[model samples]
Target: MRKIIASLFISLDGVVEAPDQWHFPYFNDEMGAAVDATLGRTDTLLLGRKTYDGFAGAWPEREAAGGEDAGFAKKLGDARKVVVSGQDLSFTWRNSERLEGGLVDGVAALKREPGGDIAMSGSVSVVRELLAHGLLDELHLMVHPIALCKGMRLFEEGEATMPLRLLSSTTFRTGVLHLVYALAESAGDATYDDAKVHLPQDEA
Candidate 1:
């Protein structure tokens, strides 16, 4: 089975929202190049209901404009999209499908598919559900330097713990730290703190 990967730009305090307010400079050459590089790696995008709505409203038009993010946005517009939603949702974008069941079951079905990997952007709730079930394979965290005092976080309360092994780490001159981790089978011998990774306090 292909790995399920989640990549997000997060803050020091674990906030994953509005990175542009902190580290993201708008549409610079480096940002464009990074967007292009990430798009080349995957063709499947998974999202929550809210992220689906947000992206659906933006990417299609951005693709049409033929602007800076246009090429990558067009690829995303054409990529297979799976949205985990409790409510009924119809998307204008082609190749988009809604997961009309509970998030866990929906993701399990997705994981059974034959593909390279399923990629997630702003699907924190869905990520949490997958992590709790130990269904995710990889996490690509782009840790930005600034700490937002308040924002939506990648982790919330009342979630089970799962252990991860650090696969790689890289630091960019822009002050973004990239940490890639893979899910590991729990040995059940080590102390919980030593074995499991916890989210930052603002994430709670």
Candidate 2:
């Protein structure tokens, strides 16, 4: 079975929105390499309607222009993209297709396929649903140093408490922490907070 891995850019206040505003400044070669590793591992992409529209608008043209992210842009453009949407998508980007049924059942079917892994990023709605259904196999959070104070959080109010086991933690010089977690079998033992492996704050 293919694993469903979600990688997200998040802020200190648990805000997952508009990572481009504050998240980009902290990015470096190390971060790029980390992102490369994740992208390399997954052959398929699972996106919600919003993220699908957003990325299709960006990556295809970017690849055509032979820009900075052209390689990755082309990679995404060429990869098989499965979008979770209610209405039928008229025109998606290259090699894209829409799943025209229930999100949970459709995605669950995708997981049963023979593949390396399926990658999802920045699709908070879909991520929440996947997490709730225990469909997500690996969760990678790229925690930035700054706090937005207000934004759509990764974990929202009235969200159920889902315990996770800490898998690994890697800190960059740019103060971005890469935290990996797996869904824990026993809440009495492992918790998500147990995954916080902190590093020294950069004194400037």
Candidate 3:
């Protein structure tokens, strides 16, 4: 099955919305490389309507302008983009389509199809739904050092708890932490005593 991976830029306070306002300052060569690595493995782009609209509106123009970002814009324009939206939408962007049927069922079907990894970005609702249904395979969070205090968050109150295991972590020079995580197979039954093994002991 093709893995569904989500890459999100989040603040220390867990805000995932409006990254454009606070995310760029920490973007550096290392962060660019990490994003490129994710895109390298992705063949399809799964996104929510808002995110889809934002990219569709900007990337094509960027590609047409033919500048430093043009290459990346072209890459996005060429990818198969699947947008999750219930409202009727005309996807004018190249290779773009609206997801058919229910979100969960549609995405589940997509995963079973033969393809490279499906990559998602800036779709908090879609990401949350996938995580709730145990559909998201990997989650890559670029945790910035700032606190937005007010914005949409990746995880909100009254939601069921989900367990995740850290796959890898890297800190960029700009203080952004690139943390990769996968859904844990099981929430381990370790207790405080089990964790005590790692504590430093005083010499007798």
The residue-by-residue lDDT of candidate 2 on 14-84, one tens digit each, is: 99997878888889998898887777456799998898889988888989999888998878887788998
The lowest-lDDT stretch of 10 consecutive residues in candidate 3 is 34-43
Summarize candidate 1's per-residue lDDT along 1-204 as a digit string, tens digits: 766888777888999876657765433455445545554457788888888888888989998999977877878987898888777777788899987457777778878889878888767878877877888887878787777889988876565566789999877767777788888877477576874566445545
- Model 2 alpha-carbon drift over 4 Å, by segment: 189-204
* Model 2: residue 63 alpha-carbon error in angstroms: 0.5
Query: CA lDDT, every prediction?
Result: 0.77, 0.87, 0.92
lDDT of 3 by residue, 1-204 (tens): 899989999999999989999999999999988887776447799999999999988999999999998888888888899999999889889999999878999999999999899999889999999999999999999999999999889999999889999999999999999999998867768999999989999989
For each candidate in turn, give its C-alpha RMSD to the true structure in angstroms.
7.2, 6.4, 1.5
Task: Give the higher-lDDT candidate: 2 or 3.
Answer: 3
Candidate that would win on lDDT: 3
* Alpha carbon deviation, residue 112, candidate 2 (Å): 0.8
Between prediction 1 and prediction 3, which has the larger lDDT? 3
Give me the candidate number with maximum TM-score: 3
Question: What's model 2's lDDT at 180?
Answer: 94
Candidate 2 versus the native: TM-score?
A: 0.89
